[model samples]
Target: MRNRHIATALLAASLLLFAAGCKKKTPVAPPPPPPPPPPTVVEKAPAAVISSFTAEPSTIVRGEASTLRWSVANATEVTIDNGIGAVSASGSRQVYPTSNTTYRMTAKGGGGDAVAAVTVAVTTPPPPPPPPPAAKASLEERMSREIQDIFFDYDKSEVREDSRATLQRNADALKTILSEFPSAVVSIEGHCDERGSAEYNLGLGDRRSASVREFLIQVGVPGDRLKPISYGKEKPVCTEESESCWQRNRRAHFVGVQ
Candidate 1:
């Protein structure tokens, strides 16, 4: 009986050890898949760029104008200095600057900024030339300047001794003027004081003018170029009743006629 009991206890112990050895173990998670490989890293692009900036005519006069031109790339906004506000990426503008000037361009984008500069040279125009010289004097103006009148004594129809020297000088001047202006004619007008009647003064004035003409002809003046006329008392130089005033009215006046 004691041996059988011992055998049964040994069998139970063996069965228990076999059941424990057949059980399965749990698995690890695998390190969470290395946190998804940290994702793919990327870098962004750079700033905007300025392609070109220039002035069409760099030099100009005071009242002249010039053209400003530019080109930009990769820019979100663009602008220019000197009253030129916002502008397109590429464009041109007309400008009139009174003096020398410098223009600057700026371009901005998500990345950074870009800048460019251009200069416009200015020069003043020269003054206009002096006005043309004055023209020469005409023939009629020369005649008025060179010729003069000769005076005579009161109530005189004949050439007086005092008037002979003046008459001779006038004859010499007439010769020179007539040589240059052959077509011009001279009128010797005889005027008298207001002393006598109109018809009587007219006859006296005629005698006076004819005597002057005869004297001019004797000094070598042509008869056809000389015309003698009488004004009588109708054309007195002075109206005052005086000898000196009357003397002024008695004279032979010379005039040029074309």
Candidate 2:
């Protein structure tokens, strides 16, 4: 009987322990939402055409050069429409035509697109008639192209050996100036091949022209008879990168002055 009582007491104690272990609990929250989407942006160019949009010697034939000049404007970027390639960011460039073409410039900025254009008419340059059949240039006249103009290499502003030859011709002509026409004088206008900044190139033009003038004086031409001017790359006889155009750009012209 004692053993039976002890067993009943043990069973009652185990049941009470099982009831106590069956209790309840609580719940959890979710993470905060992600940040809002960022804003979008658009680019634009400035209003009105930039002054740098110009073409010099606007007429030409196939495969010849024409100088493109644009005044330095406040534009951030400048591009061309001939579909050649990326336009030089520098102010001006020389362009050659494969066919008849019109070139356009675009300035791009945060404002809008500014534009400019020039047309080149390609025509076969008229040939000069026969020399003996026609009147020939005098020693002074022959010396004009030879002496008054200093030519340069593609992309170079420095005076070259050929330029000295030009000076020599001018000096020879000047020896005859008083006998020919004492009141006449000549102007040296420097030009460049299109490949760099207009401002920088123009400055180079001045140097090149001055170089020619110095050479002429050193070789015996009267310094007082000559004037120097910088056209920079603004005037290109040819705009293409070909040998011919480059040759044309590298020259200084002697203009008649009274």
Candidate 3:
């Protein structure tokens, strides 16, 4: 008892200072909820817009045809090239290119691709105009363009009553050139005028070509298509002793044989 050990060591230091001031502070775990704020990102949508590509007759002429209009926006797929594949975004197509061409268009979605181009022009065609100039191929060139020649009177030829209307218009133009050359043969030559006597002017030019082959066989021509001849006084178409040069060497001459 040293004074009861100083009051029991001051009551064990006053119960260790009231158990270190009631000892109960060990709960501080609420600072781990600040690591969950990094998850929220999503963006994508923009690219695909051509809104118009055209060629409605941009020019064409080789069997002609052209038409390829188009329009697009934020597409999901659209295409066009030479062979014009998959397409439908507001369209029209009818091409027939055979020479010059250039056409491209592509539009795709999901924010990706887009492009447009248009060009179509081609031409060439002209030639036709040259055929018209041919006609006059003989029958003695159509009887010298339709026969005509008759004269006589100075040493007389029986048919000279003004040569009976020029021997009935030379027997209607030799019956229209013997009805178109029916094996043609017409010689009635009888000319004379150097004042006769080349053997009595060949019997007065064989009675002036047998009186124009008996007036063209009484007007129906065809004493077997006539053939009387006699170049009496030797073909004197006017040796000019005059009587209008012996009436132009008395005549009744027509000749076309083949």
Candidate 4:
């Protein structure tokens, strides 16, 4: 009976412990599963860095057009200040800016946003073209080869009747110049071919120049308007030994000095 009582007491104690353990209790579930992992919200990485931008023409001419384009390594969306033609884009777009303009490109996403700006300038047209005019090429001297000189037959040494018409033309040209430009000074250079001795040639040269001047004065040109010098054979328009060249050398050259 004693053993049976002991065994019964032990059974009762075990039952009481099992009843206490079976009582209703709050569930301690792993901190409520950490608040359901906060809805497993995982933010994405920020957008890439946009160091700068590129432009079609950084400095464009006043009449030309320019485009301000931007770029980012990786982006979700892009926005630009693109004034006057401002626009928003998911990736990229183009812009043609008229006047001086600046564009800011922004990349926005989980990793954050980057920015870059591109600028373009306008230019003005160049100055107007210039004009071309005539050059002022007037003669300060009357010694152009355009005028002809008259020569007398050798040794007879007088202005011949036949040469009078030729002398008249030369005298007329000189007279016109002396009358038109009083400030201009005239010098008549005389010459001779190589027929005579140098001394005789020199004297003959002077005689020829003086004769021309005298004829000019007789034809209404003032004597004070003429000055004469003899070149002899020292100076010749052409040095050829030909008769034609020699004849050309035997003449007076008129020059004007301002």
Candidate 5:
């Protein structure tokens, strides 16, 4: 009985082992579709290039104007510094700066960024003020300076022997002026001291003025050019009551009329 039972156990174990060997092993999966070919990593190209950046007139005077220009390629974004925001890829702008300045431009794309720069120079400005006008002479000063005045002795209307030289000089000046300006006219004024009465001095002054005018006419000055007038004691050069002052007050004055 023990032998028969051992034989049955051995046969059962043999059939189980053969069945396990005959079953097909599970097929291996194809490696999860190779992880979708690693998702195809693609590299992008570089950013835009700045072809040129320049100022039309790099050197400018103060308060003057200049144009800034630039050109870029293959960029998606462009910007300038110094208060300039986003801008086109290529363009120009007018700028007026009080001082020298530098400008920088930047370009950006999917790949990277690019940069460029330009500088504008400056010069000295014009002077703040103009030159002053030239000096000129006045007409009144010229007319008064040309003619000479003649002096006289105290209370005398007669032509003095010592006064001939002065009279000759006055006559020569008048003749020279009349020859240059045919229409020029002059006046001879007679003056006296305050010691005499107004009425008596008037006659003395008239005689003195007539004497000067006659001498000028005799020396070839036109009579019409010499107009005679009398001031009497009305106009006094010296107010002091003395011989010297009185002598100075008694004189003939020459004045231009035309």
Candidate 6:
């Protein structure tokens, strides 16, 4: 009986040891999958973009037309400044600018707004300066203004020493007239002082006019361009009897005809 009791106790202890060794371990549940990586946050960018804004002819002259082309991406609204109102997202328009101009486009959407610009250069040349006024054409009048009357000493048919420059100027004026108008004609009138008698003064005037004509011929003037006539003392510029007045009355006057 005591052996039987000892065997039973050993069997009971063995069974308890076996039960403790075979028991299943409880799972740690994989640490809750690392908390699902903190629910990753995401950010979104704007949805609108200006694809293109361009001018077909960037430079244009006044009164000319240019085309403005534009395109947008993901835009709900589009507009252009400078009189261009709402327009399609992608389209073109003809623009006529009298002066330099700048065109801007605005694209709007839920995400953001985009802006773009294009310039259409306008070049307007200034009006040509007024044509220069036509040149004047009065050669004889010019010559008359340039040459002075040839004066003579009282009752003398010979040219005075001081009168040589005057004669040369007259010759130059006559040459210019003839060069410009080949068919031009001229007349030289001679007068004498009041101290001489009418007939005597007439002869003196004739001699004085002949002397002038001869001098002009020697200075390269055509003979046909010269004609001499005597007015004598009848047409005196100064009627007084003083020496100064008489000297003024004796002169050779030139007249040009075309």
- On the 0 to 100 scale, the lDDT of residue 249 in model 3 is 77
lDDT of 2 at 43: 40
Report the Cα lDDT for candidate 6.
0.86
Query: Which residue window of length 10 is worst by lDDT in model 4?
Result: 83-92
Give the count of colliding residue pairs in each prediction.
Answer: 0, 11, 0, 10, 0, 0
| Residue-by-residue lDDT tens digits, candidate 3, 53-165 | 89989888877899989989888889997888879887898899977798898888778888888888887766656555465345666655555446667676777676688
Better model by lDDT: candidate 4 vs candidate 5:
5
Candidate 5 lDDT over residue span 1-258, tens digit each: 999999999999999999998896777776555545665555786668889889879989988888889998888999988887788999998888678888888988767788998887877798877655454323234345555556677678877887788788778767876665566677789989999899998988888999989888888989988889999999998899998888887888887755
Candidate 5 stretches greater than 4 Å from native: 1-146, 179-183
Q: RMSD of each candidate?
A: 16.5, 29.1, 20.1, 11.6, 14.8, 18.2
TM-score of each: 0.47, 0.41, 0.26, 0.44, 0.46, 0.49
lDDT of 2: 0.72
Candidate 1 structure quality by residue, lDDT tens digits, 1-258: 999999999999999998887785687676655556555543544578999989979888877889999898888899999999889999999888889988889999667789998888888889998766565344467556765555666667888888888788888888877776779888888888888788988888888888999999998989899899988888877899998888888877777787
Report, for every candidate in turn, its global Cα lDDT versus the true structure: 0.83, 0.72, 0.80, 0.70, 0.81, 0.86
lDDT of 3 at 201: 78
Write down the TM-score for model 4. 0.44
Q: Which candidate is the best by lDDT?
A: 6
Cα lDDT for residue 45, candidate 5 = 67
Clash count, candidate 3: 0
Candidate 1 collision pairs: none
Question: What does the lDDT read for residue 120 in candidate 6?
Answer: 91
Between candidates 2 and 4, name the one with more favorable TM-score: 4
2 or 3, which is superior by TM-score? 2
